[model samples]
Target: MKYHVQVFVSLKPSILDPQGRTVERALSHLGHENVSGVRVGKLVEMVMEGERAAVEAQARALAETVLSNPVMESFRVEVRELAGA
Candidate 1:
Protein backbone atom coordinates (compact mmCIF):
# COMPACT_ATOMS: atom_id res chain seq x y z
CA MET A 1 0.00 0.00 0.00
CA LYS A 2 0.97 3.61 -0.54
CA TYR A 3 0.33 6.48 1.78
CA HIS A 4 0.53 10.25 1.48
CA VAL A 5 2.04 11.77 4.58
CA GLN A 6 2.27 15.37 5.71
CA VAL A 7 4.27 16.59 8.65
CA PHE A 8 3.66 20.09 9.93
CA VAL A 9 6.50 21.50 11.99
CA SER A 10 6.08 24.65 14.06
CA LEU A 11 7.32 26.39 17.14
CA LYS A 12 5.61 25.45 20.37
CA PRO A 13 3.12 27.99 21.60
CA SER A 14 5.32 28.87 24.54
CA ILE A 15 8.13 29.79 22.18
CA LEU A 16 8.42 33.00 20.26
CA ASP A 17 8.14 32.89 16.49
CA PRO A 18 10.18 35.74 15.05
CA GLN A 19 9.41 34.90 11.48
CA GLY A 20 5.71 34.75 12.19
CA ARG A 21 5.86 38.08 13.96
CA THR A 22 7.77 39.56 11.06
CA VAL A 23 5.14 38.36 8.65
CA GLU A 24 2.40 39.79 10.81
CA ARG A 25 4.10 43.17 10.85
CA ALA A 26 4.50 43.01 7.11
CA LEU A 27 0.86 42.21 6.68
CA SER A 28 -0.12 45.14 8.85
CA HIS A 29 2.11 47.42 6.84
CA LEU A 30 0.27 46.20 3.77
CA GLY A 31 -2.98 47.40 5.36
CA HIS A 32 -4.07 44.12 6.83
CA GLU A 33 -4.07 44.84 10.54
CA ASN A 34 -6.82 42.35 11.19
CA VAL A 35 -4.28 39.54 11.11
CA SER A 36 -2.83 38.68 14.49
CA GLY A 37 -0.75 35.96 16.04
CA VAL A 38 0.30 34.64 12.67
CA ARG A 39 2.42 31.53 13.11
CA VAL A 40 4.64 30.01 10.49
CA GLY A 41 5.31 26.35 9.94
CA LYS A 42 6.85 23.90 7.50
CA LEU A 43 4.96 21.19 5.70
CA VAL A 44 6.79 18.06 4.69
CA GLU A 45 5.00 15.97 2.12
CA MET A 46 5.95 12.53 0.92
CA VAL A 47 4.59 9.29 -0.48
CA MET A 48 5.78 6.07 1.10
CA GLU A 49 5.14 2.46 0.22
CA GLY A 50 4.33 0.15 3.11
CA GLU A 51 1.56 -1.46 5.09
CA ARG A 52 -0.89 1.04 6.49
CA ALA A 53 0.14 0.56 10.08
CA ALA A 54 3.85 0.66 9.31
CA VAL A 55 3.52 3.75 7.18
CA GLU A 56 1.60 5.64 9.81
CA ALA A 57 3.98 4.57 12.51
CA GLN A 58 7.01 5.55 10.50
CA ALA A 59 5.52 8.88 9.60
CA ARG A 60 4.75 9.66 13.19
CA ALA A 61 8.15 8.50 14.33
CA LEU A 62 9.83 10.64 11.74
CA ALA A 63 7.78 13.62 12.73
CA GLU A 64 8.59 13.18 16.40
CA THR A 65 12.29 12.40 16.18
CA VAL A 66 13.51 13.98 12.96
CA LEU A 67 11.23 16.64 11.57
CA SER A 68 10.78 18.69 14.73
CA ASN A 69 12.92 20.08 17.49
CA PRO A 70 11.77 18.42 20.69
CA VAL A 71 12.74 21.33 22.91
CA MET A 72 11.06 24.23 21.13
CA GLU A 73 8.93 22.85 18.35
CA SER A 74 6.00 20.49 17.87
CA PHE A 75 4.73 18.51 14.93
CA ARG A 76 1.54 17.05 13.53
CA VAL A 77 1.28 14.12 11.13
CA GLU A 78 -1.46 13.37 8.64
CA VAL A 79 -1.71 10.27 6.48
CA ARG A 80 -4.02 9.37 3.65
CA GLU A 81 -4.24 6.64 1.03
CA LEU A 82 -3.93 7.74 -2.54
CA ALA A 83 -7.18 7.79 -4.44
CA GLY A 84 -7.63 5.20 -7.20
CA ALA A 85 -4.76 3.22 -5.84
Candidate 2:
Protein backbone atom coordinates (compact mmCIF):
# COMPACT_ATOMS: atom_id res chain seq x y z
CA MET A 1 0.00 0.00 0.00
CA LYS A 2 1.00 3.57 -0.53
CA TYR A 3 1.21 6.04 2.31
CA HIS A 4 1.38 9.76 2.28
CA VAL A 5 3.75 11.31 4.74
CA GLN A 6 3.78 14.90 5.88
CA VAL A 7 6.90 16.09 7.63
CA PHE A 8 7.08 19.30 9.60
CA VAL A 9 10.47 20.63 10.63
CA SER A 10 10.88 23.59 12.93
CA LEU A 11 13.70 25.34 14.73
CA LYS A 12 14.19 24.31 18.31
CA PRO A 13 12.99 26.78 20.90
CA SER A 14 16.52 27.49 22.01
CA ILE A 15 17.65 28.11 18.45
CA LEU A 16 17.43 31.56 16.96
CA ASP A 17 15.17 32.04 13.97
CA PRO A 18 16.36 35.15 12.16
CA GLN A 19 13.71 34.94 9.46
CA GLY A 20 10.86 34.61 11.91
CA ARG A 21 12.26 37.32 14.12
CA THR A 22 12.68 39.64 11.17
CA VAL A 23 9.10 39.09 10.15
CA GLU A 24 7.90 39.67 13.69
CA ARG A 25 9.87 42.88 13.88
CA ALA A 26 8.44 43.99 10.58
CA LEU A 27 4.95 43.28 11.84
CA SER A 28 5.52 45.30 14.98
CA HIS A 29 7.07 48.07 12.97
CA LEU A 30 3.96 48.08 10.83
CA GLY A 31 1.93 48.73 14.00
CA HIS A 32 0.78 45.16 14.55
CA GLU A 33 2.01 45.23 18.11
CA ASN A 34 -0.38 42.55 19.23
CA VAL A 35 1.52 39.97 17.21
CA SER A 36 3.94 38.62 19.71
CA GLY A 37 4.99 35.21 18.49
CA VAL A 38 6.49 34.02 15.24
CA ARG A 39 7.81 30.67 14.19
CA VAL A 40 9.18 29.33 10.93
CA GLY A 41 8.99 25.77 9.68
CA LYS A 42 9.15 23.62 6.59
CA LEU A 43 6.66 21.07 5.33
CA VAL A 44 7.60 18.14 3.12
CA GLU A 45 5.17 15.70 1.58
CA MET A 46 6.00 12.41 -0.04
CA VAL A 47 4.36 9.16 -1.17
CA MET A 48 5.91 5.81 -0.47
CA GLU A 49 4.86 2.21 -0.33
CA GLY A 50 5.14 0.29 2.93
CA GLU A 51 3.28 -0.66 6.08
CA ARG A 52 2.10 2.41 7.93
CA ALA A 53 4.22 1.81 11.00
CA ALA A 54 7.40 0.99 9.12
CA VAL A 55 6.99 3.84 6.68
CA GLU A 56 6.39 6.30 9.44
CA ALA A 57 9.44 5.13 11.30
CA GLN A 58 11.62 5.38 8.24
CA ALA A 59 10.32 8.79 7.43
CA ARG A 60 10.89 10.09 10.92
CA ALA A 61 14.40 8.70 11.00
CA LEU A 62 15.19 10.25 7.67
CA ALA A 63 13.95 13.58 8.87
CA GLU A 64 15.79 13.41 12.15
CA THR A 65 19.09 12.09 10.92
CA VAL A 66 19.33 13.50 7.43
CA LEU A 67 16.78 16.08 6.44
CA SER A 68 16.91 17.99 9.73
CA ASN A 69 19.33 18.92 12.43
CA PRO A 70 18.27 17.39 15.75
CA VAL A 71 20.25 19.92 17.76
CA MET A 72 18.72 22.95 16.07
CA GLU A 73 15.40 21.62 14.88
CA SER A 74 12.60 19.19 15.65
CA PHE A 75 10.46 17.14 13.31
CA ARG A 76 7.05 15.54 13.25
CA VAL A 77 5.67 13.05 10.77
CA GLU A 78 2.10 12.29 9.82
CA VAL A 79 1.17 9.23 7.80
CA ARG A 80 -2.04 8.37 6.02
CA GLU A 81 -3.03 5.65 3.61
CA LEU A 82 -3.46 6.80 0.07
CA ALA A 83 -6.81 6.32 -1.63
CA GLY A 84 -7.77 5.04 -5.09
CA ALA A 85 -4.57 3.08 -5.52
Best by lDDT: 1
lDDT of each: 0.92, 0.89
RMSD of 2: 1.2
Mind giving the per-residue lDDT tens digits that candidate 2 earns over 1-85?
8988899999999888999999999999999999976988999899989887889889989898987889889999888899975
- For model 1, residues 13-73, the per-residue Cα lDDT tens digits are 9999999999999999999978999999999999988999999999999998988888999
Candidate 1, position 51, lDDT:
94
Each candidate's number of clashing pairs is 0, 0
The alpha-carbon lDDT assigned to residue 5 of candidate 1 equals: 93
How far is 62's C-alpha from truth in model 2 (Å)?
A: 0.8
Worst 10 residues of 2 by lDDT: 76-85
Show model 1 residue runs off by greater than 4 Å.
Answer: none
Q: What TM-score, over all chains together, does every model reach? A: 0.95, 0.89
Window of ten residues with lowest summed lDDT in model 1: 76-85
Candidate 1 local accuracy as lDDT?
0.92
